[model samples]
Structures are given as structure tokens and as C-alpha cells.
Target: MPVLIPTLVFRPVSTQLLVTDGVRSVGENIRDALRTHQDTKTLGCHVHEPIRPYWPEDAAAQSDRIFTGRYNGRRFALNVTGGTTLMALGARRAAAEHNVPLLYVDTDNGVIITLAPDGSVTGEREITVSVPTSTYLAAHSATVSAREPWGKAIERRESWLKPFLEAATVLGQAGGGSERLLDVIRPVCSGGAAGPAELPEVTTAEESLANRLQEFGMIEVARRGGSLQVQPKGDERIRQFLTGHWLELYVYRACLTSGLFDDVCLSVDIRRRTESGTVVNECDVLTTLRGRLAVISCKTARLDHKDENKGAVYELDSLLQAELMGLYARKVLVTNRLALRPPLRNRAGLSQIECIWGPHLPDVAQRIQSCLLPGRR
Candidate 1:
């Protein structure tokens, strides 16, 4: 038999365009994209630190930060920013030199330049940008608009919502949010394609809820007019949406510890560049339990807990961060499935590792609450 070997290339210059007409537009767009792409399994952005190889100060050295992941099997990177003229010019220049697309989100709408391989801009394409109404803007424009403290709270929430919006869009699309539900009703309803009937009746609250559902990869807009119609993508979307709340509970449950130790906050992956010019991505959870900094490296069944040689389980890596946490701190690994080796588990200098099953969140939460209480053991 003839032998055929598949070739793979690890490094190739590939990029995608991301832009929104304004802050709110960008937020909405990102939210939509995130929901749409969440269900393809392991759907999350892979961030990298800025790379400046032989870059002069005068030259463009910094690449705009991007969030890259898969959507419908197509790869895209979104570059979201508040409007700035200098950044706009830089984006255009970068697109031409590197052969990437550039999207500009402005006050009114978004402008994108589709580039050729040689880096010449194609025809300017404009897309509708979602923005808050003028009345809403006027109410929020002043520093002390309406209630003195309310504006700040609103701003903070908006800041958080922007990123979430993008995540929702990607997940929503992947999980078949609308399509899943639509399939259930398509046969029974009067119309052969009875997708619209599957959606809830249109209302302000309903629309907002729909948007939120879209973020979770549960439902999507099938048709929009005076009354917007929604439909499910598939069975997976329905299952994912129905179980999302439970999944969140499962995450909380998995992280919870037993009897003693309080103050638990769900940790997420955060990436930053080191001074040594190396880009590093960290996967850990950090919390202060009674002024003691506890840095935990969490793992799940879905996650691979091994390095190259596989002689030593990878839990030892968590200790390196403990050294960085200093003497008044601790390091631990939280897992529902994987168990560590004896020597590593029996170390006197290290804290006892903790594990919680998929069903044990309440116990973990109680333990965390106990840890945080004053004068509690």
C-alpha cells in the first residue's frame, strides 16, 4: 500500500477584521458573535502578547489586541476599540502591509476594507452599527446625569456587557439556539417552516431576553420586521440552552471546597506579557481567604493535565506560582476528576489539594463561606 503523510504548518500569518461603529455597537456585535460560536466545543478566544521583533519606535510596532476563535468553522479575530484617529490610520497601514482586513467602528456606522493578497483596499463596505438613542445618550452624557452614582454603575455594567455580548453571539450560533427550538415546532405548526412561531412574543423585555439567550447559543433571529421571529438551530442548541444554568451551577459546584475556607470567586483565563519579552497565558484562579492569597490551578475532565514526558502529573506547576505568591500564601489544585501523585500530595510545605465532584458546589460554597468568616477555623 502507498503511504500518505499529512503535512501541517504551525505558523502562518492569518488575520480577521473586527470593528464596531461605536462603543455600544462594538459591544453588541461582540456579544452576538460570542453566542453564535460558543458550542463548537472549546470555543474561547486565544490571546497573545504583543510581539515586537526588531521594531523601531517610529515604525508601527504594536499590533492591536484581538480576540480569535472559531465560528461556523471559519476563524475570525475581532479588534474592538473606542474611536481614535491615530489607531484608525495605524489599522489601515497594518492591513496593507500584513495582508489582513481592517474594520473601523465609528460614531455612526462601521467601515471595513476588504484587502487583496497584495494589500490594496477593496471597495469600502458599510454595515449598520447599533448605538444608543440620542435621548439615552443625553441622559447619560453628563458626569452627574440623573442620579449621581447611577451613571458610574451603568458605565461599569456597559463595560462588562460589551465583551459578554461578543461571547454570546459566538456561543449562540454554535449551540443552535434558535434552530433547536424551531425544529421541535416546525412539523406541528400550520406553516411548513414554522420557525417564527417558536419564538416568544415580541416585547421590550422579550427582545432583551432574546439577546441574552442569543449570547448563550440558545436562539437566534430567524426573521426581523415589526415583530422579530426566532428559531432554534438544532437539538444541541436546545440542550445547551436548557442546561446552561445548570452548567454554571456545575462550574460553581466544581470549584467549591469542603468545611473551612471561604471567599470564592470564579476564576477565568487571563493573559499578559512578561518583561522578558515572552508572551504568557495563565490558567488559574485566585482569591484571598482571610487575607491569605490562594492561587489555584483548576482542571476538569475536559482539560488535559499533562506535560510532555508524562512521568510527573502536571499539578506540580501550580507550586511555581505559589512561590511567586510569597510566604503568606498557598497554592492548590481543584479538580473533580484527576488525582495527584503521593509525594506531591504529601509535601509539608504545600497545602493539601482539594477536589469537588460535579455535584458538590453547595458544600464547596459553604466551606468557602466558612473560610471567609471572621474568627472561624
Candidate 2:
């Protein structure tokens, strides 16, 4: 077989177009996508920027220049996988005029289709591509400032934290019980304790649960005047095991356990500079699979009906902002709530956002697996 040299000649649409359209032009996004594929060796990357990116003549002229100047007398193919309609038209015209092979990617189906010089479909095949962790970060204009492999971290401490997580689940399900429980424990954990007289009355089951916590050395208990005085050990381990950090850690670990993602980063702080100034966003969990990106936002707060609507809007906006960094990036929201309101669900659906609530928390890995599956997007 003759050696095939792949030169990715693409166009970068104007920044104004990207901002107005809420996504990077197809050409820019496809370049990143192609760079991630292991089988694709890019010999050269030529970016054609037209004065009027929306004009076919300008786009076509740029394409012709690249084809004749750099790709001339070379065994190459023209991939018109992205860009505006006029941009595509320009590239198609150049390909037909030059008798170069034309190619297109069915992104929705994970297939690469080949077209004859005349623009007829000649053949196609499915392909699996994955982005490296470093490449993923670079694509988002982010860096790995710190690393916390939540899955491995939790697995190392699961023996002790398992019971704590179970207890937390019980308290969490008691509606206001979790907050009350935390209130009772915070003072004790801080090296202070309420007198028995100042303690709240507890049911037999609540008392038993307290005893379990005491046995774990997470708290101390004193009984006086038929009331239970509690003090927390205030250990870092105890705090992390009991607080909302537990849920966030659980979600991260779940994603790691799925064995689906090529890369996973927990607690990523992404900073981007704009004309005005620099802006920063904290991502709870970031993962990449099959060359696609997914940003998972984990929440433990219970929002009321009105707050739920607001929360949905806020999350959607955040996801959209993240999308600007990585076009085709998936948006996911993970929460402990039973379910998002119908309106919230509808809004998420329209935005291509995935909402995972309490019941689905444990199945996050499977959900992510499904999201990364070919043609699922």
C-alpha cells in the first residue's frame, strides 16, 4: 500500500461569527477533533481565513490557494467536514476543480464518508476516535493545575467511609434531618459541645445513629437530664466524609469506575481571558471519551419549585459558556434531588443537557457510557 500523507487544510471563521452563533465554526472544531484521533497523522495544518468568511468566492479562493500552493503534487484528500455553508461550497468547488478526493464526516454517526472528485459518495466506514487528556485540556484552553483522582481516593478509604456515606444517605432522605444533624455535629466537631439541656430531643433511631457515629470516633456523646449532648471530633476525614464533598467525590469516582472515559479530572478551575478581563469557572468533574468532552456539574442543594427553574437556567448558561470553549462538548448536571421539574427537564432537553438526579447517581458511569457511545449525540 502507498503511504498516505494527511494534511488538514481548514478555515477559521471570524470570532464575531463564533460569538454570535454560540459555537466555534465547524472548521475550528473539526481541527481539534482530528488532532485527537490516534490513527490520523497530520502532516501539516493550513488555516484559510477569508476576509468575509460567509462569502463563497472568498472561501473558495482561499481553498484553491492552499490546494495549489501546499497540497499540489501531493497525494492528499480534502475534508470538508466543517465550516459554514458557503465555506463548504467554496471547498467543494475547489475540490471539484482540482480533481482532489473529497471527504466528509458524519459526526452524528461516527462515520467517515468519501466522495469522488465529482462529489458522489464512493465509500464510508465507522471509526472510533479518542482525545488524550492533555489534548482535551488544551482544546478547552485549560491546564491541569491540580489532580484529585476521586475514584481512586475514595476506593482507598471506602472501608471507613462506607458506613458514613450510608448514615449520610439516611439523614439526607429525612428532608430537613440532614441539616439538623449537621447542626448538631458542627459545634462538637469544632471542639465545643452543647450541654445536654441545650440539645434537641431525638427519637430512639436518631440516638442509635449517634451512637454509631460515636463508635467511629466521629463524635462524643454525653447524656444528662434525658437529653443528648454531642461534640464532633472535627477531623478532616470526618468532615469530608459527612459534608456535601461526599456526593461530589462519589460522582467523580463513579465516572472513573465506568472505564469509559479516556480522561477524567476532578475540581478543574478553567480560566479564559476576554477583551474585558479574565474569567474563571470551576468545574466539578470533567471527562473525555471518544474525542468528545463532557462537563459534569454536581449539586447537593435541594431547590424549591421556583429555585429549580432558576437553577436550571443557571446551569444551562454555565454549560453554554463551557461549550464556547469546546464545541460539541456535552453538558451534564448531577444532583441529589429526586428529579428536575418538568420545565427544567424541557429546557435541558432543548439545550442538549443531561440531568442526572438522586436515583440515577449510582448509575452515572453507565449514563456517561451511553453518552459517549457512537451516534448517541
Candidate 3:
């Protein structure tokens, strides 16, 4: 049998590591990760250590050592699923030197990629690995306890929000008619206030539009004294549907519809300890494609703030968090606002973040697909 050599890296999950057929690991972290996930049960597990992952020479030396001894005569394939860039570079050198094939798992596209010894793409073969959601979440260090199954949650939300989202789009376009109705209901839906005593009188034309919103089950009209009372459904679902969470759900649905990702997580709560204390970072959406990570931040509110520096600061902080996830992970901001001020845009450019906004919001799946195309990022 051909021997598979893989470099080890720090990972919260072992989906990628387990899916790739290999025996190579250069660190205790990866070895433990694989063992905890039970990947070592089916795949060959070879653990070696004391090699520097960030030094190309050290990584290359480790690869050389693995190739020596009893394993010398077997054909070798380098699987660069884990490890640092230095380790990848060193492994690439080793592969080229031995004229062996290089393999990589593209998690996003669910494909096994083959590269010639010279680092040229040779082929891509699709794969199906049965990885449970709980296993995947555990690998990523996410708190799976008390968390709803993402697929079930998504299915429930999609059914509940379909008509609500359609109404929102119409309200977005209908201007004052929509605005007035929202004003009458916002207090009831957002705050714990009772329904408004009376809605502002509407023109005959606007009255029909208001009736349509009621017909859509977005609100209920009741008579109070000598006037019409407007009461929006104040359930938690409605509150979330009306807020930024709606946009987050929209983006998540779009990603699901596109079918371009290997795995997707919505509202992933990641906790990490800092010098001060433990902090929780909630990502709107996290996706893996073609073995790269994509961190998407969805904003329904305006991107521009009166305080010029505020928006830039927020985007910068988000970008920094994405960088911490992985070196080559894509950082993206998706917003329904028309545009961000030039400063914020410039900051995004400087940080290598892809901003999708305005009209592009409707075509989010296509836009994200474009970003994931080979040679784009």
C-alpha cells in the first residue's frame, strides 16, 4: 500500500484531517484531535514529534526522517491537510524531490485534489465522508451542549420566515406606506409596549397596502375605543425576524441554496480566553470550501455611522478575528446598506476583506461563489 504523509496543525475539529487518508502528524495536538474524533481507528496513525512546524528546514527534515527505515520502499503521497505554511512548503519540497504525488482535501467542494510533484494541479475527485454534526462541532472547540441541530433549526426558520421576509422586501420598496405601518408596530414588536391605540390615517391607496400586510399575518388589526389598533405579533420569532438576525438567516439560506460549501455553520458561538477573561465571539456564518475557511458577517443596519471611525473599527476587529481562525481564511462582510463610506471601504481593501452590499445582497450566493472560484482569492 502507498504511504500517506500528512503534516499536523492545531485544529478544533478533525473532519478535514480524518477525511484525508493519511498516517502523518507532526504534533501532539493533531494526534490528540484525531484520536478524540476517532479518526485513528480507520486510518493509519503515525505520530512523530520534536519538529518545528514554522521552519521549512525542520519540517523537511522530519519528512525525510519519516521516509527512512522500514517505510523506505513504499510509494509516498504527501497530504497537506493540516500544518502551517512552513510545513506545507517543506512538504511540497519533499514531494518534488521524490517526484511523488501531492494530495489536498478541499472541504468546501468535497473534493480530493491531486497535484503533480511540481505543484501543478493534476485532478480533482469528489468524495463523501460521513461526519456527524456533533463530531464536527466538537472538533472546532464549539460548545455543542444545549445547541440545536443546525439543520433542524434552519428548516424551522426557513418555514417561519418565508412570508415574513417577502413582506419585508415589499415594505422596503413601498416607502412611506411601509414605514408608517412599521412605526405603528415597532413598539409592540421590539419593546414590551401594548399595541398602538390608532394608526395614522392612510390614503385610499395606502389603506389597501396596509390591509395586505395584515393579510400576510405580519400584524393584527383590532378596534380600541373609536380607532384602529395595530398590534404586531411579538413572539420571539417575530422579534428575531424583524432584526439583523433576519439578514443572517437570509445569508445562511443563500449559502445553502448555492450548494457550493462543504460545511456551513450559522451563529457559531466561539469562546476563547484572553488575558482579561473568557470572551465569546459569535460569527454570523462560518463556511468551509475547498479546504479554506470563510467567515461572513451579516449587517442589516447601515454600515456608515456618524462617528466616522466607528464602522472602520468594527470591520477591523472582525477581520482580525477571522485571521485568528486561519491564515488563508476568507473574511467577508455582507450588508443591505447602499454603501459604506470610502474610509471603511479603504480599510476593508487594506485588510483583504471582501465586502458585498447593496444590490449585491440579492445575489449573495453568486457573489460568494465567485469569491470561491479557483485563482480568485
RMSD of each: 24.9, 7.2, 7.3
Leading candidate by TM-score: 2
Over 1-377, each residue of candidate 1 has an lDDT whose tens digit, in order, gives 00000000011133222322332332332233333322311223222333222232212334323321233234332232332445445554544455445333221222333445344545544432222111111111210121112223223544533333343333232322223333343442323455544444455644564566566565576535546566544654243323232222233333343323333333232232234653332424444433333445534322232332131224434433432222323444443332334454444134443433323433444443433233331
Model 3, backbone clash pairs (residues 3+ apart or across chains), number: 6
Clashing pairs in 2: 188-231, 188-232, 189-232
- How does candidate 2 fare on TM-score? 0.69
Query: Please, what are the lDDT tens digits per residue for candidate 3 over residues 125-196?
Result: 764433322333333433322124333465466465567656655543443233344445556676757755
TM-score of each candidate structure, all chains considered together: 0.28, 0.69, 0.63
Candidate 3 has a TM-score of 0.63
Clashes of 1: 58
**Local distance difference test values of all predictions, in order:** 0.34, 0.58, 0.56
As for lDDT, the candidate ahead, 2 or 3, is 2
* Clashing residue pairs for model 3: 12-139, 12-140, 13-139, 107-291, 108-289, 108-290
